[model samples]
Target: MADPSNELLASALSGEGQPSVVQLHGEESPQRCAELRWLYPAIKWWKALRLRGEEDLNGIDAYAASVDALLLDAWSPKQLGGTGHRLDPAWLERLEMRICRDLPWWLAGGISAEWVPTLVHQVSPFGLDASSRLEHSPGVKDLRRVEALVQAVRVNSGNRG
Candidate 1:
C-alpha cells in the first residue's frame, strides 16, 4: 500500500501505451477504494470482488458506489484470484442493468467460449474476464481458446446493436 506498490502502478500509468484502466483485485474496502480514487484521480479503478453466495447480494451497491467499476468473480476458499470457478448466474442477475448506467462492471471466473453468448445477452456485463481456464499450464495459454472467446464476444456484442 506504499511506495513499491504505488511505484508499480505509477510506472504503468506513465509508461508507454499506458493503460486507461487498472484493477484492484484484493480485499480492499470501499474506504480504501475512495482513498485510492483520491490518490490517483486519473486512473479508472476496477474493483474486483468475489461473490460467495446469495447473502452477499446486498453489498454490491457499496462497491459500485465507490469505484469506477465492479468486477464480480467466483469465490473460492483457497484462491484470491484465478480460481476458475463460477458464481451462480442468478446471483449476478439480481444486480440489475441500472448500475451499468453510471459505472460499468464485469463478470469473471470459469468463463468460456460456450457460455459467452448466453452471458453476453442475459447477464449483460460491461465486459468479461477469461483466464485460468484458458491456460494449459500455470502461465501458458492456449491461443485457440482465447481466439474462440474473442470471436464469441464479437458475435454476441454485434447482436446488441
Candidate 2:
C-alpha cells in the first residue's frame, strides 16, 4: 500500500496482531518514520536506507540515532525494491562499524536462508529481512520456506551461543 492512511495504520496496530516491527522501505525519510510513530505508537519503526555506493553513507551515522532500527538494502538507483541485487559486503562491513552497533538493524536485499549463519557471524544484526528469497513470487510469501528458515536460524544461533 502506498503510504498507509493514519486510520488504517492505527486499526492494524490495534488489532489482535503478533508482536511485530514496522519497516518502511522505498526511500522513506526520517520525517515520514516519525509521522508513522506518531500515528501508530505500538509498532516499532525501521527506516530503509538504500545505498548505491560507498559515498551514499556519508551522513547516515548521524541520521541513524532517530530510528528504532536501520534496514540496509541494495540501491538500484532506478527501482523501488526486489531488484534481486546484493549489497557489497565491504560496504556493509563499514556500515556495521559505523551505524549498526549502537542500534538494532536488519540487512535486506537478496538474502537467503543459507546466508543467515554467515551474515549473523559477520554483522550480528538483530534479524534478517527476507522478501524475495522466501517468496514464490513478489508479495507472496512461502510459509513453509519461511518456517524452515526460522528453524534454521534458531538452530544456528543456539549453536553459536
Candidate 3:
C-alpha cells in the first residue's frame, strides 16, 4: 500500500519478524522515499512505480537507488493499481538503455501467461507480478491461472537459456 504512515511501516517491521518483502506501491516520488529512508535497513524495500507518462522518467535513478528493487506497474490517475490496464511498452523501451540497463526491476499489472515472452523480450525485467489477471474475482485467486503463469515463466526462461 502507498502512503503508509511511518508508524505503521515501523510497526510492521518490528512486530513478530520482518516481512520477506515490503513493497511501497503507488509511490513514485523520490522525496517521499527519502522521508522513509530510515526504514531501509529494517525492510526489503521494493518500490512499485506507477507509469503515468513521460514525466515519470525524471529522477528514476534516485528512486531506484533508494530500494532493493523496483517494480514498474501501470497507473491511471483515477485508479490505485489492479486497473487491468497495460503499461505503454514504449515507456519501457525508452528506458531500456538508461535506468533499465542495470536495475533489478519487474513488471506488473494485467500480466498473463501469454504476455510473458513478449514482455521478457522487451524489458528483460527481473520478474513479473501478476495480480488481477490471476484472480477469479477481486481478492479471490484462481489456482489454475496462477500455476499456468508459473509454468509460462519457467518454459520461457528455459527457452531463453
Candidate 4:
C-alpha cells in the first residue's frame, strides 16, 4: 500500500509488543516514506527505494531524512519487489555520495555470490538481500549458492568502507 492511512498504520501497531522495524514493501514511493515516519513516531520504518530511470537522488537526503534505513531495489512494473532483477551499478555509483551519510541502506534485487566482490567495490550499501537470487526455486534456497554468498560477504566485508 503506497499511502496506507494513519489509521491503518496505527491499527497495525496498536497491540502490545509491536515490531521494532517494519519494511514498507508494498509502498514503492520513497517520498511517502517520510510521511509514514511522521505518522509513527516510535516505530522504525524501512523504506524500499525502487530505483528507476532518472531517480531524483539529488534530493534523497530530503526523501529519506529521518527514516531508520532504506532498501535499494530495482523498480518493476509488474512486481513491487522481489523481482530477481539487478540494479545497474553505473547508476548506483551516482547515489554513493547522494544518500544521507548516516542513513544505512541495504542492496536487494539481483545480488548473487559472484557479484559480491564487484558490489563491495562499487557500492557502499550496509547490507545485501540475496534470497531470490540464491534460490533454486520458489521458497527453496540452494544451500551451495547460499554458502557461496555467505563466503563472498565474509571475504568482502573487510573491503567495504
TM-score for each candidate, following the candidate numbering: 0.82, 0.70, 0.85, 0.85
lDDT of 1 by residue, 1-161 (tens): 22226567667677578666778877888888877778778778788888888677676677765699988888887876788898777677777643546778788998898888777666778788889888889878899989999998888884532
Root-mean-square deviation per candidate: 3.3, 3.9, 2.4, 2.4
The candidate that wins on lDDT is: 4
Q: Provide the overall lDDT of each model, using Cα atoms, as 2-decimal numbers.
A: 0.77, 0.71, 0.75, 0.78
Ranking by lDDT: 4, 1, 3, 2
Clash number for every model? Answer: 0, 0, 0, 1
* Candidate 2: residue 26 Cα off by (Å): 4.0
Clashing pairs in 1: none
lDDT of 3 at 79: 70
Q: Report the Cα lDDT for candidate 3.
A: 0.75
Give one digit per residue, the lDDT tens place, for model 3 in 1-161.
67788787777668576677778885446677756665456556778888778678666778765677888787778877777778877677777657845668888878998887776666667888888899999989999999999988887874431
User: CA lDDT of 124 in candidate 3?
Assistant: 68
Give the alpha carbon lDDT tens digit for every residue of 1-161 in model 2: 23666686667677576347876665556677677767666667777788788888777765464568887788876775677677776776677777746777777887777776666655566777778888888889999879877876886774432
Q: How many pairs in model 3 have backbone atoms within 3 A of each other, for residues 3 or more apart or on separate chains, i.e. clashes?
A: 0
In model 2, the worst 10-residue window by lDDT is: 152-161
Task: Give the lowest summed-lDDT range of ten residues in model 4.
Answer: 54-63
